[model samples]
Target: MDENEKDRILKVEIDVSGKLHLTPEKKKFTLIYRTATEVHWNTEINTLYSPKPRDWTYLEWFKHIIKVTKEECYCELNITEQTEWVNIPNELKKEITKAQQWL
Candidate 1:
């Protein structure tokens, strides 16, 4: 995927129902939650492709699976009141900042 697509994905948010909410357009996408092991096995079987193979971290895998499934969005399971900000990737951070300006 290109930088634009990646940024789009990064701008998404998860709603209370565990659904992914896309930005600007406010489109909702369903997610098929998968374990890291499942993703790994799928990759091994050629059922999935890492967008960034060199940096095939769990987050990348999550993004890749979401893109491939063509789902609306992803919500990290087990979110709580104490949920904290994840370490946003530099590229994604830029997108978030840009997105905030429109709010």
Candidate 2:
């Protein structure tokens, strides 16, 4: 996937009514959250203009699931696992930029 898509995935948040916190599937990138009950409480479905308020993020939704199911839940995503970033000295950055200008 492209960097933009990766960034988007990193920022993805969805509310679900299932036991699973977040399930990433195909179709570009789909996160399926399953709660104990079969009822769907997606905040996206209740848009801002809708009668219901759209105030639940994925974390909030998951918390609701925990309240209803009373099950221990934990989800992890290593977004930066593939990339490492370190501070670069200003002089080194200038040198790198100068070198790039030659190419």
TM-score of each: 0.24, 0.21
CA lDDT of each prediction against the hidden true structure: 0.34, 0.27
Residue-wise C-alpha lDDT for candidate 1, range 23-98, written one tens digit per residue: 3222223222354322321222222323333445434444544443443233222212232334445675454445
Over all chains combined, what TM-score does candidate 2 have?
0.21
Report how far off residue 74 is in candidate 1 (Å). Answer: 15
Tens-digit lDDT string for candidate 2 (1-103):
2222112012222223212222212112112235433323235322111112246533344334323322212322222222221233455334433432332
Which sections of candidate 2 miss by over 4 Å? Answer: 1-53, 71-103
- How many backbone clashes does every candidate have? 2, 5
Clashing pairs in 1: 29-72, 29-73
